[model samples]
Target: MGMEQQAVEIVETNKPVILQGGCLCGAVRYQLSAKPFDADYCHCKQCQKSSGAVFQVWMDFKREQVTWLKGEVSEFESSDNVRRGFCKQCGCTLSYRDTRYPDYFTLTIGSLDEPSLIKPNYHIYTSNQVKWLSITDDCERYQQERTS
Candidate 1:
């Protein structure tokens, strides 16, 4: 089953879901009150550089749904209006935020305490994907950002 289905099953359980996670050094911790949405594998150049990976899995949540339980993430503007968050202690990429979407916050799936609980539903920015890497998933592929 997909991550979306898994998340739905979790929510349907009627239990209070408090998803928790942190940075590599355990210095930056967070909790999510609600399940995340728009989970995808991003192949944008910025994502690749920031994550030091061919692609990065990210999921979006309403800003209010997330609470910092421990140290806060240090952010750097990756582009004109886009900011990326990371732990200062261990430099683990944590989040991505765009000024255009002030109400939404995006988190790296690798930062989650249970990364297996979520999965990428699609692939974005395929135009920038590495030539050596091959994506064999059946998920939708977008050359750029997925237009709703």
Candidate 2:
């Protein structure tokens, strides 16, 4: 239910491994390649408003592993070719896709049963960071978007 710090077993080698995820209602299910890359947290207003929480965690993985398990997902065109996929029943975000990055899909890290395996590597939208919530000096903080 909260951010995990414990590591999950690495079920595979460098080769593609099955990674599982689904919505809160379990209506929409998906699988992605294991060994996610560039796991991070977003603090942008749109993300805060969309999640209605402190922040959103995301893990980048190859898109080929993602698929609809049970039913269809409602999509919102969040950005250029980037569609936000969520379950119609639970209204839980499943993943985000962009044809530009068709090879990589950014999956919600919070959706993972083992979020501990993935930790926030960077913080985005530090310029809009809440005054009451201070950013730790340990990790990189970008005032705006950091492509790198």
Candidate 3:
């Protein structure tokens, strides 16, 4: 699924806003109680391989904001800093976590029940994007991470 070009700022307050979603097979159900942040399209090679797509759209929410309401997920240590979570039954990418940000968990936007609520603000790792792929969006494109 393609994300909107507009950047969305999510601020989490004491009050929780429930965002419900799950896997394709309904084997994994979850709820996020806080606003999400850093929603972006990542063109990194690892993300392309993990999602089997040209790019992956991800959004970060506080670790405490997420509640797994149903089945457990299988995890793969994709890199020294990245651990990816997928539904065991459906083999759908569910979540992503980087060791550098232990307090946050990034979820695949395609798995969300309300994906339209969030929009990608930028493109990360644009240097690694597939040669055949052309990005036409007006969003900011970073050579690597946003910080870099």
Candidate 4:
């Protein structure tokens, strides 16, 4: 059978439907059972530093939806309110979690196996975006964290 057909069959079966991914060194693997929400580009300084980029694309999912399939991640309290998880072996940032929002996790889109399938719907903390870095997309832009 075709790959697409096999995927459909896997979904139709009672078997787990998971989106798999790992760190640069393949030491930390993960699985997501459900699609993420609130995909966006974050220009916050913390995101920029963690990703070593002008901005970071992140997607949110319920904490329960994620399952660690391989090596465990090393977590650091990036700030008083946020904790970031990454692969200690390769320093590949994987996720962000807020102390206030324990039920949700923010996963780095770049870490996904098929990142192109999930597009950022908006830009957040745009006020902190680098002056030289400009957004051309018509997607909604928020000067700070999105209220909605």
Best by lDDT: 1
- Candidate 3, residue 10: CA error in Å? 8.0
Q: After superposition, how far is residue 7 of candidate 1 from its true place, in Å?
A: 8.6
Predicted model with the maximum TM-score: 1
Better model by TM-score: candidate 1 vs candidate 2: 1
lDDT of each: 0.85, 0.69, 0.84, 0.80
Clashes of each: 0, 1, 0, 0
Candidate 3 wrong stretches, greater than 4 Å: 1-18
lDDT of 4 by residue, 51-90 (tens): 9999998877778988989999899998998899999999
List of clashing residue pairs for candidate 4: none
Q: For residues 43-134, could you state the per-residue lDDT of candidate 1 as single tens digits?
A: 99999999999999987888999999999999999899899999999999999999987988999988998787776778889999999998
TM-scores, all candidates, are 0.88, 0.77, 0.85, 0.85
Choose 2 or 4, whichever is better by TM-score.
4
Model 4 / residue 10 / CA error / Å? 18
